[model samples]
Target: MTEFADNVRQAAVAMRALFPATPMQRNAHLSAKYDADIWLKREDLSPVRSYKLRGAFNAMSKRIAENPDQQLFVCASAGNHAQGVAFVCNRLDRKGVIFMPVTTPQQKIDKTKVFGGEHIEVRLVGDYFDDCLRAAQEFCAAEGGQFLPPFDDPDVIEGQATVTMEILDQMPRVPDRIILPVGGGGLSAGARAYLNALNADVHLNFVEPKGGASLTAALEAREPVTLNKVDTFVDGAAVARIGANTFSVLSDTAPQDVLLATEDGVCTTILEMLNIEGIVLEPAGALSIKVLDDLRDEIRGQTVVCVSSGGNFDFERLPEVKERAQRYLGLKKYFILRLPQRPGALKDFLGMLGPDDDIARFEYLKKSARNFGSVLIGIETKSASNFERLFGLMEEAGFVFNDITDDETLVNFVI
Candidate 1:
């Protein structure tokens, strides 16, 4: 075995001492839909409901073995990584200090606490992740404790490689393609390294949220670059910058292998997996699956594996997820219509509705002129083509309207 493969195998063996390998199940629903043999490496079933715990455990275990006198561990994270570190602290009976942004959801903080119990102390340090990370690093330096990075460390990368080791062992043969979600790139880098060492014939596809395409941006720049802004809707994988160490391993990857998934697009996949397969996936977890539509032609009849990285979804976000899915599917839209100030104006507009059209919202914006008034309307329809027909009717009837469904600025203020 190559050195990387040996390290991955060692990580896998070390993992078994803590918890059983996560399932690599063939997803019948996705396989039939995509016309391919689709498998999900279910990292969502890990003890921390994420593959992150593997890296944290592997890194800490190796460190402890080398120096048994080391007693303190420190890490900073907003979600999965925090839980992973906390879990390892509890498992190893070691004291750990975790720094998280004050803006972190209560659900995540609670889960981290549950996993760490008395072994970990969570410090709400700053409003932004970067600030919390700084605080954690300072604390680690002051206390002379080992700092456990979420993805930048080599040991953590080696730990994450264990997932690929399990995938190969569970499958009958090497998969034709493997899809991975990239955050700071720990899992992607590790898995890619191990798989490349084991079988050069396998195709690797990397998925990143469009709003936070750090990996894609880095690949284009030929180095890791920090994004000016990032949409944190997919919090689990929304990283503004890729880790320097993780990027080194992924730098040689071809640009064509990277795919970007929009937040709304990912929401659609999340809802589909929940409704159709009874699977609950966080936005990050759904990243790989969301890109299946884009890979339909290439993966047909071929064996493919998509890693469902985490299920750390907050139930409170369900409503927002549903809203995003509807918007992406074209089942919902918002518009500002100019209505004539005639007695039968409302009735004339209602007559244009298709059989499947439903008015979800309606409001009068203002009387821009004596002859007309601006109406804010939200419509839901059965099919996307329905909008074209509706628009034609509006044009023929001399009704003026503006579609604000995708206007982020306007929707944020008025919708």
Candidate 2:
């Protein structure tokens, strides 16, 4: 363990040539919210706005040092990892090929290009990430290039440990608890291993997106298993399968501490941090903060550290994030109201709305019968309880309504 710690320290020293240690600043908002000492390791402030660059740089550097003639590095990623690999390849003056799904956002592709400049080539392959992975690997093998695994590789995991090294160096003392967001599990495994290796008195808490609870599934089966379905709302931390190597390291941690956070819960945190703290966080970056309410009992009076992993958030998705948060908080709702095709009928329904309620959407579906029409109405209010009152008023006024906000299938079909 100590030997591994020494190696991680060496990696930290080497990383200084690229960028200084990421900050570990005490967060007053979180500390006050939980009545506990809370510090955040701001990996989001890294050159690539993520810790992924550490792994990509470390693995690539070691490989090149061993074989000077090996100049090609290849990877498949649609998000932060792509940017990370691109940034490192350009920084090290090595050639790289980054393959991303065809559906990947243009903002991300542009950012990756900006990072790689002339040192890398960006390839758009299949529509799905798995397809992109297959294409990337086949291309790498055919071209005799080194394939950089995003998280599963040993060297990559070792490099991610540098985060923990920085944490221990920056903080005044060892934290009583460390909250980590897990996707493929690289960051969590690396940070946990380093903390345990250093004999730090820290209880590790792993948080996964509820839609992609790969680590939770692995811990339950006592081994890694693939999830049949996963929601990609929290794209940064949503993985259908946890890496075998990562699960091997995580198997020793308390399974109960692995928290599966709702995507909406993470959205809530994202919006809260943005509005309340003036902090911009991507969905996955807010995972640790989202689960703090669940850990309130365990974390009170204890020093805690939450790693804000990445901030490469595209503003294009901000509307979706806001929508999800509103739905989760009951502040916004969509309903189908059956109204009689009469002028006073519409006026009566409008009068049912409370003073705080504002109509955000109004679409006439169609006339269902001789005297009734189906109208899709969206309402937004300052407080959640306003909806309850509005519903009661609608019911008392003899209007029939169906809430389709939480109905996934109906929403896709109608809304």
Q: Provide the overall lDDT of each model, using Cα atoms, as 2-decimal numbers.
A: 0.93, 0.91
Tens digits of per-residue lDDT for model 2 on 119-220?
999999999999999999999889999999999987888999999888878889878888889999999889988987988888889999999999999988
What's the TM-score of every candidate structure? 0.97, 0.98
What's model 2's TM-score?
A: 0.98
lDDT of 1 by residue, 196-216 (tens): 787657888999999999999
